[model samples]
Target: MMIEDVKLSIRHRAQRNYERQFDERNRVQTDGIVTLGRLTIESPNKNMGSEYVPSPGRLIEHAFAHLPPDLREYTFIDVGSGKGRILLHAALHDFKQIIGVEFAAELHAISKQNIAAFSAANKHHPPISGVLGDAIDFIIPDGKCVFFFYNPFGRPVMERVLENIAASYRQEPRKIYFMFLSLKHERGNDADANRELLERQAYLRPLKSWNANRGAWIKLQFGSHKLTMYETADAGNPIKRRQRGANGAAASHLE
Candidate 1:
């Protein structure tokens, strides 16, 4: 065989091996452990087992790659943080504060353990907090923030989360950036159900969708997949009105 052909064969074999191990590790395990960064979660769906893989760590790293340098001063929050990988990485990036909210008790405990292990390994690093609570009820910090999601749940739950965010913005308007990954599904259409919920929320604008390279790697293992990033505009001053004239009398007098 030609030298190039031989090299290609080796690459193909290596790729296949990687997929086989991923499948074996993920297949039939009840705590959905999707590997994103160093974190993994037990898939909430018991039937699927906890093998539901979250976004790969590389993809998330890419998502934050374009963030302005100033975002280093903001807090980064990850909802449905399975094992706190995102939070930990955010800390390394120098985000002022990093918070991860997870609903599963077992996963939350695991996350804490992982954080401790990481902290001990990197003694000089800042701390990243992993909260044992539902993302819906967790208090959002007041400041420029980055919210990340990896299709943590169904559409209904996403709607409620968006509503909560809207309410938070209303209370204290600030800049918010949303990083959504793995948005497409096997059905091959934009996940409009959740997208619609985001569209209706005030003070949010769909900046644009950029094709993420991480999807290519995922596709190599899981057939085909795509990832998109959508950013939300900074919340501006709340709409208010000035009393320009006498209430009821002014209208009649002008007429």
Candidate 2:
């Protein structure tokens, strides 16, 4: 393995060790995190981008803070939800329903097992399920919902997924939120490209965005570890894209 891969291995091992120790007492297995190769999953194509990386518990909390109280009434869906970390967290907060869509059979099985164990341990969690298939094929159910994407797939897959969300909105016409956490967001790339894509979509509207460099540029912060959350016009109001931020330092074009 390359040096970078080696460092990632060390950190991953440390995280697993800590989770194993803690999950033993908690009696829930949700600490394992690993990035797999394309061959690992029985996927339909190679457009599935990104590796298995869990959003830190803190980042999830920070995101929830920005969401509305109506969150309790919406179904939470995590696309490319490997290991179902976000689903597990959403369950604790009691979303009406929690779903994770993972194509990898092995990872899907692990998520199912984790959800069962977690529900057994915490009876207060809401209904949780796992969809074992390609994310591109997922049809957003009719209802108030929140979709989460951790840079799960490449641009092509993301565009398709967004189309599904927009279709669901037109069919149901309810409040929706797309919380996207793009790692290492730069000036121009898929991160910006996806944001631009969302902005251009007539059905979907851009509300607001928050990322690592939201304010003043912080020193020594690694870009890969950063998070960006996009909030858009809820429900329908004919708003497609928000204002184009010209003076901003980061890539989140939510304003």
- For residues 63-84, what per-residue lDDT tens digits would candidate 2 score against the true structure? 7766676567888999988887
RMSD, every candidate, angstroms:
9.8, 6.7
lDDT agreement of model 1 with the native:
0.60
Angstrom error of the Cα, residue 119, model 1: value is: 1.0
Candidate 1 contains a number of clashing pairs equal to 14
* Model 1 TM: 0.66
Q: Which number leads on TM-score?
A: 2
Estimate the TM-score of every prediction: 0.66, 0.74
How does model 2 fare in lDDT? 0.68
- Which residue pairs come into collision in candidate 2? 207-232
Best by lDDT: 2
Q: What digit string (tens of lDDT, one per residue) describes model 1 on residues 184-230?
A: 44343234555665555545655453443444544544332344454
Candidate 1: Cα lDDT at 39 = 36
